[model samples]
Target: MVTPENVSSYIQQGLECEYIDVDGDGRHFEAVIVSKAFEGKGMLQQHQLVYRALGDRMEQIHALSMKTFTPEQWANQA
Candidate 1:
């Protein structure tokens, strides 16, 4: 029973993010994270960082879909 608030709070602690949107139906979530911390990290590392932030809650959370991007990547999309 991982709430959106729980995920939001956890992620905000590790990353200097511009935006974080989390949508969850209690057990599953879709997270869109935009942060400068993703700058030189690969997709696996980015996801790992997020997983670390969540701790054991990942097992409790059934599903997590993420769209992560660095600030520069985000800026390029605009």
Candidate 2:
């Protein structure tokens, strides 16, 4: 079974994000990710990027609820 730590590590490596919050019970997760890489991307693209980061683990992980934002959007929210 995939763990939260494993998921966090994967996302960190894959996206190189500045801020990330991951909460889950291994099979399901909710993540709030902030990265400059999302600046020009639409919602679908952003989610796709994160999904790609998770790799095939996405199949193992079940549900992933994500709140993605660009660096600028994160800064504004803060």
Candidate 3:
């Protein structure tokens, strides 16, 4: 069974995230992912990057709602 941490770890593999918090059970998940890599990326590009990081795990995750932010963006949000 997949857990939040499993999803979190997947996203962390390819992205250099300042922070990552994932919530939910095996099928549904929500993530707050902060990374410097998202700085100049468009919404679609950012989402694609995250999706790529998840790779095959995307098949297992039924609902993945995410809030992606650059470090600068995150600082402003805080």
Candidate 4:
């Protein structure tokens, strides 16, 4: 069973995050990730970075929806 915690862990292991929140039921998940790595990247590129972070673990996930933001972007979202 792939819990939100597990997914969040996987992402954190592969990427450096300022903040990350994940919520899900088993295989489907939604994540909000804040990272410096996403700075100057487009949405698609940001997503790709996350996908790379997940690596082979992505296969276990049936669906993943993510909101990626740089530190500045995250701060201003409020």
lDDT (Cα atoms) of all candidates against the true structure: 0.85, 0.88, 0.91, 0.98
Q: Candidate 2 on 1-78: residue-level lDDT in tens?
A: 878778888988888798998889979888999988898999999999999988886788889899999989998895
lDDT of 1 by residue, 1-78 (tens): 679988888878866679899999988899999887788999999988888877876778888899999988878887
The clash number for model 1 is 0
- Candidate that would win on lDDT: 4
Q: How far does residue 36 in candidate 4 sit from its true spot (Å)? A: 0.1
What TM-score, computed on C-alpha atoms, does each candidate reach? 0.85, 0.92, 0.94, 0.98
Give the per-residue Cα lDDT of candidate 2 at 55.
88
Rate residue 56 of model 1 by lDDT: 72
Across 1-78, the per-residue lDDT of candidate 4 in tens digits comes to 999999999999999999999999998899999999999899999999999999999999999999999999999999
Clashes of each: 0, 0, 0, 0
| Alpha-carbon RMSD, candidate 2 | 1.0
Q: Of the candidates numbered 2 and 4, which has the greater lDDT value?
A: 4
Which prediction has the highest TM-score against the true structure? 4
Of the two candidates 1 and 3, the one with more favorable TM-score, higher being better, is: 3
Colliding pairs, model 3: none
- Lowest lDDT 10-residue stretch of candidate 2: 1-10
| Model 1's TM-score against the true structure | 0.85
